[model samples]
Target chain A: MRHFVFSLFTLLLACGAQAELRVFATVPEWAALARELGGDRVKVYSATSAFQDPHRIEAKPSLLAQARQANLVVAAGAELEVGWLPLVLRDSGNAAIQPGRPGYFEAAACVDRLEVPSVVDRAHGDVHAAGNPHIHLDPHRVQKVAEALAARLAEVDAPNAATYQANLKAFSGKWQAAIARWEREGAPLKGVGVLVHHASFTYLTHWLGMKELGTLEPKPGIEPTSGQLSGLLARQQAAPARMVLRTAYNPEGPSQWIAGKSGTPAVLLPYTVGGTPAAKDLVGLFDDTLQRLLQAVR
Target chain B: MQKRIAMAAMLAATFGAQAADHSELAAIRAQIDDMKRAYEQRIAALEQKLAQAESRPAAKPAPATVQSERTDSRRPAAGPASGFNPEVSLILQGQYKNMKDVPERGITGFWPAGGHDHGEGAIEGISKRGFSVDHTELVLAANIDPYWRGQAIIAAIDGTAEVEEAWFQSLGLGHGIGLKGGRFRSGIGYLNEQHPHMWDFADAPLMYRALFGNHGSYTNDGVQLKWLAPTDTFIELGAEMGRGANFPGTDRNKNGSGAAAVFAHVGGEVGVSNSWRAGVSYLTTQAKSRAAHFAGTVDDEVEGLFDGRSQNFIADLVWKWAPNGNPKYQNFKFQTEYFQRREKGDLTCATPEGAAATVACDGMLSAYRTRQSGWYAQGVYQFTPNWRAGLRYEQLDSGRRDFGDNAAYLVVDSYRPKKASAMIDYSWSEFSRVRLQYAQDKSMFGITDNQVTVQYIMSLGAHGAHKF
Candidate 1:
């Protein structure tokens, strides 16, 4: 019995030493970022897919289980995950990943946010008080988040600090070059007028200098009513936008209806990694987005 | 001859002074030139260093330009004055119920253990007829500190208020361990811990009504400890000890804990679209002089008192499915729970004063033992974003009753009680919902009550997220 117990303990120790770190990401974009930075040293799990709405994901048992074993929690904070992340963290019983700990990383905190409401009220329909959290759309913002996340990884796993830093430097080099290329290629998109299904493309539009004419939804989270759709249609007739923009997860009904009525094309942009078949990683996401936008205009 | 020599000396002296002054002026000019050259070289070096510093960042213009642009547009919004205040929410609920007016309603084949008074036409404290305000709840929650969080839920009904739950939980206990203390709903069964406002139906399940009195569920002052295993699949073990002052067990003035319970749950996902959980629990408590009522021969009422130990076991299961794990469009959940209880001790039966002499008037105490069980199954489906429908069925069994000497006077029916309910609800948003429900309750022997209900629940203030 003593020998068996000792062997069991050794087995557990071996399992523990196998994985350098366990990362729990609240969204696919952050999960992709963590994998890029951590490389082969970390086991990462994403709580929600690219197609799921981060604002409404349930704190399911599987998520709680993943959180329980996580050494670090990477989130797209700024209240983007306010609905479920807190509950999952509280119930996880893993003290290392608590809000104030070194193991907790929020990418939204690393970048400047847009659409900050002056007045915080639900009357405006589910507005985030900390500003828009869709910072991953901009390559520059993604680079900033990557730098901070690499630093966070080093803080939690000090022995691998140099490796994390090397990884960050490599990622930044590739990302910066990509940004330069995209900026040059997307020059024609400057000042292009567009309509969006939701306010989910603030960073993307801001990056490419595109003009947002209107949104389908009357507010942030409310579904578009027919009256609101008609109002947008009338506005489109007066000053037609070049195209209507929506993410892959957004319903196709409203955008299609408006596009058919207003002769402008409807463009479906991959909002994150794996949002489209071509968008399998971070770079592919922007590539597909730009390609679709450019196709639409042509 | 002396005058001529002095004039020559004076001329020589003047010539010497002019030459020395010329050399000194040339030397001063050279010194000024050297100083100008040194200053020019230093300025050039400093400018070179400045250009190098500036060009270093310019090489990576993406982050620099984006950073500057971000700072240019970054307008830090001022948060509300009550940012640090605890989250407070109020739930307003009211319902209109229609049912048969029955006097002295009780479930047949089941020993009445002080549950809701069905005879008074109240189902889970909701009035049976006409319109009435249901229970309204006010909830406040906040993190007390780095190590603890506190929450309080106050329920108000008919101008009176009561603290339904006030508990503090340990926040920083590592190693997958959690501790909670104070008055809380016991974490014994899946449905036990959920507040009535979160229930799918307007009323409590028949099994819960039979097990716990009008309260429908058990809440007591207690402390609980839970541990979650570090595994791929979800597994949790919990134990609780509390003052058993409600339902099935009478409040005793003893010092130590009057009840203890332990439970374990395991769950996992089948695929991206489905998940399931199963749990089992056991509870034990003591009852002293628990009061109950039963029918007697020829339209007579007998009062029965029981003193004994009660032990109950519960098993529960739940399954949920969504399209690609996105529940915003459509989802379905099915859950079921079964409960079995055993009680052993003594029972006494007696007749009320001014009543004619009847068999119950013998007033005899006898050794009593019984085993009773019940189960309920429910399913709720969300066909669209704003609409949902649900169906529920429940039944109770009175397995055995050994009343001993009191059995001759007390009445025992060989009937089983069951109920079926169907409901549909609409939610314009997450904060408000209106529901319509109909139920056929054959819980009482020889009586089948068809009930209809319309209820509305509206939430104000902080939005609370639901947990699965």
Candidate 2:
């Protein structure tokens, strides 16, 4: 009889162990952020990897299954996942993670957005109509998002409120210190000129005060016409940028071609957490990015 | 005795002194207990204070979740989450076709596929020549309320218009239960639910055209209930009830219950790069005087009716591969579907004079019991972000039949029909594509045609992402 009671007690604990909150994030950056905020109290899954374009993510069954059981959903929003996220949420059959619920957290909503367009034109290749949604690259913005996510995790899984609070306290202390160090190291990038593959780095450029020398795409999502490529080539001959920036996810052919012909160095930034081997987490993401920019300068 | 009494008195005096030391030890023990009680009281008070502090957080009303959505200037001013602004999008589709001229053009032995006409794509014998606008689809979708979301699609084909799909589905059903109602595509086969524009090739597979009347699977007024099992592997089961007003159904122009279907699917990932899915489905329906027969093939063919009960069975499988689960640069998808249909009823036939039959008979009846089956397999590979190529092979068999002396009605080699097609396409973006395709079609017995099609699909406004 005693053995039976002990076995039943063990079973109860095993069931409780599987009760951790499930988090479904649209990008790896948000997944890393949730891991820091939720600690061991949650199991977080990212729909897209660091080496994939977030704007054109395909909806897979595994992703839908995650959404169906997710207690919280963190996304970049502002139409960053406008192509896929809505459908996934609708099909997930899980109402807890739907938009407008406390369980839904959009990172772009946590920060001051950049380049709010005065007009909307989808045909011109400016895909995101609600301004740019790639706001995760800015450390200050990421800190703000992390604070919101921590509070959301507490609200969604109230039983673990204390755990979330402790994790938040620890993360904020370390993240703030890291931010200050990054600002000091990135000081040299303040007026450095750069050409980009797309407008994906507007937040990075704004935060570091880097000069934007236009983009190789010419128009946002459209392939550059020969005329547009030649125009960029001719302009580069006159006033070349110090660095041509492209994320690991974006195709490298165009940026490398421009770099080769225009005599500029092309630098691949860790656009999100785990985009490169060195960027295994949120802090490493920024450290690697800043280090690359500084290296290009040297 | 007096001396002993004096010694006893002295012993008593010593015992009294030791008793005094024992009293001092008891007093020390009491003092220690009093200190422990005092410390316990202090700790309790501190714990109470800590609990109160934790219970009452700083009165900062958490950053209103509403403020996050309002920050985006793109949203309509002051219109929150449920503001009735539905997403609207327009699709423009056009195509050019070139095929060899033949004395007759028709898919030979498709019996019940002559009636329903719903979406895009050509049927067996209706292939056109030259340039034409195939279809322009208009789509509108939005969440109706917290519990429901609705979508409507209208297709404009040639000079006619049709509602391809219009349905409202439950949004709040958790644990994988889904409820959908209204006119929509039935999810019976792997490719049955996808629209023509989403197909890898410009033309429908020969098997699909023979079974679904050319535009892939036909849509119907219906309601569906689906459940996804709570397991690690992807398992789904669904049942649907629809008004059988179209081909193979012969709604008989009546409104009563006409058709019903049930399906089951299971899928799981093999590793980091490979994923696979397989499904089995069954559909049963009754057709009252269903209209059918070949039209203007070799001669003016006549229209006939098959009044009976029909049943169809479909088995399908799909396998996808992408290294490390990243398919942007390269991926391969192989899919195949096999279907068998059984019909039992009375079929009425006519003479070669067709609708103009004068003497040979206006009312010719034959006991009809027929079984037909077909299968198609296709593979698509995306070698680059913008370039892809696909190849497909299809075959159909006109199954065992007893026509009751109407041997003249049997057309072509009833046992076999085969077709092979290959295509390559380039996508400008996720929303736009141009494709070139060629095929050798022998759906008709002893007749072959080499066909070529150049097609383009362009989208404007909002387009939702496709599901895999």
lDDT for each residue of candidate 2 in B1-468, tens digit (9 for 90 to 100): 989999999999888888988899889999999997677546544543442233211122222332345543223222222246787888888888898765434467777465433112323323667777776889999888878999999988756788989999988877788889999888888888887778888887877777766566867788999887766577789999989776678665666679899999888778767778899998888888676554433335655667898899999998988866777678899999999989888867554332454323236787878898999999999998788999999999887876654445434236588899999999987788999999998887787888899999888776777767
Best by TM-score: 1
| Chain B TM-score, candidates in order | 0.80, 0.78
**What are the runs in model 1 whose C-alpha is more than 4 Å off?**
A1-17, B1-82, B113-125, B351-359
Worst 10-residue lDDT window, candidate 2 chain B = B55-64
Candidate lDDT values, in order: 0.82, 0.77
lDDT of 2 at B422: 94
- Tell me the lDDT of model 2 at B43: 55
The predictions' CA RMSDs to the true structure, in order, are 17.7, 21.8
Cα lDDT of model 2 by residue, A205-246, tens digit: 867878778788867876555677678778876776898889
